[model samples]
Target: FHDFLSVLLCGHKIQAKLSSNDKKLLPFLASYLCAVAPEFKPFITFTEDTLKNFDAVIATGSNNTATYFDHYFSKYPHIIRKNRNAVAIITGKETPKQMQSLADDVYRYFGLGCRNVSKIYIPQQYNLDHFFNGMYAWKQVINNHKYINNYDYNKAVYLMSDIKLFDNEFMLLKEDTGYSSPISVVFYERYKDINDVKAQLEDQKQNIQCIVSLEDVPFGVAQTPALSDYADGVDTIDFLIKL
Candidate 1:
């Protein structure tokens, strides 16, 4: 809801369709919207036929939904579809203070946003104590959630079954073969040379969004994103303008 409001404030007329489960929150949210921006009366229901009336469509969803959007909306002149994603930073010389600040990027919004850092690429010799200590603040939040409980339970079951996966409160399960988004998880690879690391990152470039690294390069920043940042392999305005 806040995300939509942010975009709408930027001069966009958003036509939102809430999932059936989210319908209960619509009336309250609508009332709030009316108070803030009376011109924006968001609709609650939608049908397939109604979608054709739009000049352009911007669909934000999972890889499955991206596939569906591609099949159904590709015939249209303008369509922008995005897959789920997140961001992470790599720091070889991270101090305790830096790690603490980095925790904000990882745990904010329950690590749900596409820009959240789901994985960190750190040197093999990095101190785990500093990283975990920084993230300790999230323990209570993770314990109070039902979804995190399910993930932890499933993680334990997988461990008992000798299934290899990552495990933690905020994130777990790495080495996944396909698209990984949300639910923070880190995958590590050892490199003997800088060229090897560069080659590996280049190979996975298509699947990557922001790369947080200490290396001085054109897109390698500490923990911030520019306004022009693109996500999930698509441009935001390009997608919106097409629609």
Candidate 2:
């Protein structure tokens, strides 16, 4: 939103209509925006009614809300975001420090961020010890009551379903093909070849946010995206300029 505002301000005067499911967040966010750009204060609003009259919209919402945005804003120029997950490529050759960094990337924000590493692709016959040891750095997350509840619940459900999992006393790792994993859990899948994993990920690019690897995003920095690192790989500034 800030980037869009910056680009839009380069030309015409702007009126920003803001609406959030968390009503309390709007006031704080609006105030912060005003602090950053005082000129935005008068032009900003908290009403959804004004949104319909906007010439263009850039919306980020939940899967259900995105569907609504797609239909309701179809008449206008818009950018609507859907759900996306991040995955890590585990080659089993990472140094102890890199392994720790990968763990930090996954457990940061308690694995709630869209860019958090929720799944991993590892080579066949890879040792799990390296991953588990690295994850020990975030064992404190298991002490958070909300996080622990989800952890225990997910552990019981997986056990009851007879699903195989790697238990680390804090985080659970299971072999699965899905991208999004539950809180306190991460999904992993073994690959016979790196090329195959890359090919598969390419086919699912639309559903993926970032590919964390020694080569791609580097470990422990998924949440700290550079200005050029646009979400869903779409260049927002460029898109806004094109508009």
Candidate 3:
């Protein structure tokens, strides 16, 4: 929605159909936006049929929803999106400050946003003490009832299933190949070579939103995307210009 908000500035008529699940929070959000930008009030509507005549479409959601959007809107000029997650590459050489920043990037939004780092790649045989120490700063996140509930539940399930886990009270670190981890958990994989990790990431590029490391988007700042840093690496402005 933030990206498409620019469409209005370009003098294009823009409206959105709110999904059934998003109704809980989107109405309040729309009301707040309308309060500040009255011109935006009319562009939001609850009726799905109101968007039947749109010239172009921008759809974002899970993979299943993306499939449905592509099927329905394929005839139109559209940018349908699937879920994408950010990841971090951790070298053993990071300073404590950088580690802390990475922790903030992972925990800032309680690891819910697509830009949040849901996984990390660490060097083989790397000591995790530094990482755990950095994460201590966000230990207070356990105070959130919802977050702690997830933490406790996932921890118990993992323990009962005999899955090895690294527990930090508030977060669980699991070794897994997946990108999207459960709430309060961060999936991880060990890398013997950095180039191998890079190759795997390239192979799975469509599933990844951003790479956080010293060489890529930095340790922290994944959620703090610049206006031009388009989602899924698709340049919306360029798409608009071409259209």
Candidate 4:
């Protein structure tokens, strides 16, 4: 549902490939078109074998599925996407409003979309109190059943294994090296050098959708992707034009 919602919100920016692990979305998409598609408008194709007919293809899925698409679509012109995430870098100088806005980037869409900020880079010795002050505004997310359920599940698993986590009922923060976080959880890493962190991020550029910072895409704007903001930094227009 999150994937479909993301497609509905941002798919028009480029030719989107809506991938489902199962073919469950077929009926749903078809039903939606039947209900809302206007009579004068042309119909979009609905097909079981989507890959065979298209001249070129764009596929989105998990890291493992990406490898499968690469092998199968190598002969054809295609784009195969792997999992990616957005992250924020904190300098501890941000105002309460800035942190509040950052909370929106973290909590909006329940943090399921790729553009959602799932990790944070903060300076050493940064005060957690200030960061929590900003994040506190979004505490109401715990009231959501789905979000709370995920929170409980992840928290239980971690606690059973004796893992340490910094949490405030609704959100969990863990010091980790990974870029991706599980639902209802966010990873955090402390950084001493901005340039060093930038270099590190560049090393793993393919796994990142975007960087959220005061200097880059501002807080609360991750969901509002622009025409040029192609996922994984692939220029879809250039790729299409060349094809």
The Cα RMSD in angstroms, rounded to one decimal, for candidate 3 relative to the true structure is 2.3
Q: Using TM-score as the measure, what is the rank order of every candidate, best first?
A: 3, 2, 4, 1
- For residues 143-229, could you state the per-residue lDDT of candidate 3 as single tens digits? 999999999999999999999999877889999999999989999999999999999999999999999998999887998988888
Global lDDT scores for all candidate models: 0.55, 0.83, 0.86, 0.79
TM-score of every model versus the real structure: 0.70, 0.89, 0.90, 0.83
lDDT for position 84 in model 4: 93
By TM-score, how accurate is candidate 3? Answer: 0.90
lDDT tens readout by residue for model 4, 97-119: 99999999898888988899999
Consecutive 10-residue window with the lowest summed lDDT within model 2: 12-21
The lDDT leader among the candidates is: 3
Best TM-score among the predictions, by candidate number: 3
**In lDDT terms, how accurate is model 4?**
0.79
Give the range of the ten consecutive residues with the poorest summed lDDT in model 4: 7-16
TM-score, cand. 2 vs. native? 0.89
What tens-digit string does per-residue lDDT give for candidate 2 at 111-168? Answer: 8778999999988999999999889888888889999999999999999999999999
Model 1 steric clash total: 3
Off by over 4 Å in 1: 1-13, 20-33, 40-52, 87-89, 163-185, 215-227, 238-243
Off by over 4 Å in 4: 1-17, 20-43, 48-50
User: lDDT, candidate 4, residue 54?
Assistant: 50
